[model samples]
Target: MCYYLKLKYFTLHGPLPGMPPQFLLGNLAQSGLLFDKASLPEAHIAFKQRYGDIYQFWISSTRLIVVNNLNDIQHIFTHRNIYDQGDIYVQKFSIVIPHGLISSKGAKYKRHAGLTLPLFRRGKIVSNFDLIVDCVDKLLIRWRTKSPQHVHLDIVQQSQNLLLAIFGLIGFDYDMETLDNDNDTNKNELTKALQYFLSNFNIMLFSPKILSTIYFKLSSQYRQSQKTIEQYFDRMIKQELDNGKELIAQRKRTSLIASLVGSLQQDEEMETNKSEEDRKGLSRNELLDEMRLFLLAGFETTSTALAWFIHLMSKHPQVQQNIKTELSNNNSQGLLSLDRLDSLVYLDCVIKEVFRFCPPINGTVRTLTVDDRLPETGAQLFRGDQILIPFHSLARDTRYWSIDPELFYPERFLGADKDHHPYALIPFGGGHRQCIGQDLARFELKVIAARLMQYVTFGDGGNQVNSGGHLSKLTIIPKHVGVTIDFDK
Candidate 1:
């Protein structure tokens, strides 16, 4: 917390404070403190120390304002009427996911969010818990025969397999045998498509036009991946429409996409007497766009969270014991009753701490709808300017937490940090647009973590193999996560 002056400079948008000399490289693609890929969450802290909570990373025409303050993020997100998710997101992402909840604006956003929400409601998630855990059991069975005791498993690959299988079942009523098969090149088409698409979607979106022309010429694989995924959606949506009400009974227990399809089918059937223009059914392309976004968000977030949880548990044996002890006390005969999972208070704290420690989606961007001022620094901003709320900085700011923010202690939730600022640790974000699948994500994490702790012990695999860093892409995934798991009697 060094003393820094609030230096304001005039831009086309308005008066805004720019970054410090340390971030003078002024490159959003490389050295941007807010958007740096190599730096993970540390970049937010570095900029906060140099320029404080609110400032712009003004690189020429770019007027991206970075806000790490709780009040500021709260204000921006809470006032959804005033400020939407931002046009940059809509303009860029909508090209891929048309009318998707994240990409849709205003009324469309509300309609999509409201419609898809029931599928992720707490009751729906609980009833579907066993269905979700089916994938986890398959993964555990595979793990048992992978190698001998004290073997290092590439958790990055394992998590990808597990989540794809889980989401496949939940989302499409399909079985993706990514966990069973050993072949890489001949793996599931949807899995391959997702891996390729998420890895390259942003690059293709933001690259310079001339360079993008060159990129498209050279990116045959990327084009094929997108086409493959899109084709699958085309077939599914066409099948649902050409056939009729295939998944009505399992709508509540299935993926959000399934529910959407079932609902849309009902809408179409009810409007049989209406004109084509008056039909309420979602068009094929629109539903496909949402399906792509749903799969991308669904599989990535929970898997990344579980991977981090396993890594942390391996690092801190005591925390694992605490979770296991809680599970043992339940005396439940089954894998995990909803009541038993609910009672694991300590595991809940660990889940929260992991989200704070290393969030999958580090931060989100918003566009100002009207001229506004950041109250803390009094920096003036204009309409259409981009604002970034770095979750890393908010979670790490010592001022908001009673305990040290740098520590990996989950006990803080039960003790000193109990009263920590609500907006300080928003892994799934906050306000109206917070992650709709958070309840599902947390339930999945707890059930899997509890099962793992009950059946096995994570042995430290040493720094050489378990080297810690992160890969910042669609999600901030662990770049180096290798841990040894041994089954317990």
Candidate 2:
């Protein structure tokens, strides 16, 4: 026998004790189907009934071990060394976009995350509430004009514009005001790039490697769109570098890019006193990478979450009414401020519940770094083995959440229930590798949701809202949604 045969004999000696494979597509046919129409709750229900809490599934040729039990999730997240960040999908993304925090793994991830973390410190986020409120006010102004008309608003577009405005203000100190203009090129290109990235999710279901390669090569439009995105940032970064001194002198600025560039420059100056060997600062490309990630990951994920929140609110009118009443009773003027947003318990519950109902990233894959057996299942997994955790399925598992897993109930997230198992609700993920932008994203959602509720009354736009056939490259997003926005005016 060849060396390959010897390795197979050593590694794949016996059948794993879990759900039997489904010939070709494996459990993916039942679980990994298109997101837009896929009933994640139903899929989890079926899996729980058939294969128990822990089961084995396959997507393409890759084997996935799904875990619904909270203990399993805690074990997986806490043991970061054993479960290193998965590189299969990140490697594919690096081909099309520059690798940054989201794609970088291991020590590189650690270093970049450290550098980026200080920028999003709680104080900075609190200080920047006005910038967020400003963007929301612009959106509210636009909504007021369309109110009472029962406009069939492309909510996805609206949310994208609102997020882009926030990104522009913070990322580059460029006030996009995209909501004012419907045909802005920069806004359009950003939206298109996000859509392309979203499409990559399902494209992975078919043949990720081949499709990704083809997408980078044959799709000239996508390539150009990406280039446009890069160029836009490049110009903004260049402008900042050119005017850095003046901006720095202007004190008390809230822009994220301003803070980053200032921090880098300060680090560079401080490095001058140290030995050349010890001096380390971000290069031009590194700065761009950080900015790109902030714009792309920051805006895209927040926009998608906000869109889903609105859609869910529309479907559940009572929840919307409760939210409205809560806001009405409270002073709407100061509610958008960070202090007030932090105090809004019900608002926080609603946002958390939205995440439970529809997590932006359905699942994350991690490759095993050491040969080990799953604690609960006792199944042997070798180094280089890939494990998939489907958050979409886990969040709605009836075993963990008893209150009609599919329903949108914010109360389930409040009070004592808030202290439920860590893994039970992982919208922002768990452990050290959790999303870096969680706090910022949550703040953005609360500020936006609170402000919008103050001015507009969301209603079912006479169209069924479903997260079917949803695609995800980096984050999960609704495909195409049309909702009616009725203004409170």
- Of the candidates shown, which would achieve the greatest TM-score relative to the real structure? 1
TM-score of each: 0.86, 0.83
1-489: candidate 1 lDDT, tens digit per residue: 122311222232335445433222233444443354545366666666876778665432234678877777778888776566856566556555656778876656765665677778777677767876677777778778755455555687678778877776677665667777763446678778788877775464444334544675578897798799888776665654444555553553445655667556445455657754455545545677778877788788999988888888888999988887888884755457777778889999999999998888878778877888766666677788788788878887888998898888999999999888888988988767678888878887888787777788887787876766777767878877778888875
Q: Which candidate should be chosen as best, given lDDT against the real structure?
A: 1
Those runs of model 2 whose alpha carbons end farther than 4 Å from true positions after fitting are: 1-14, 17-49, 147-153, 183-187, 204-206, 245-279, 330-336, 463-474
Q: Give the TM-score of candidate 1.
A: 0.86
Q: For residues 1-489, what per-residue lDDT tens digits would candidate 2 score against the true structure?
A: 645633432222245535544434445565655443444434555676677766665554445666666776677888888888766556555655444666677655665565567656566676667888888888776666664645445776678778988878766777655776653334565567656655554554434456557766787876776687677777776767777567744532455565556546445456557653454555455566677678877787899899888878777888888877777666755344555667677888899898887788767767778987777766677787766677887777777775777777899877546676668888877766677788888888888888887777767665554433354545666655656777775
Off by over 4 Å in 1: 1-15, 19-26, 29-37, 58-62, 148-153, 183-186, 202-218, 234-243, 246-255, 263-279, 332-335
Native-to-model Cα distance after best TM-score fit, residue 411 in candidate 1, in Å: 0.6
TM-score of 2: 0.83
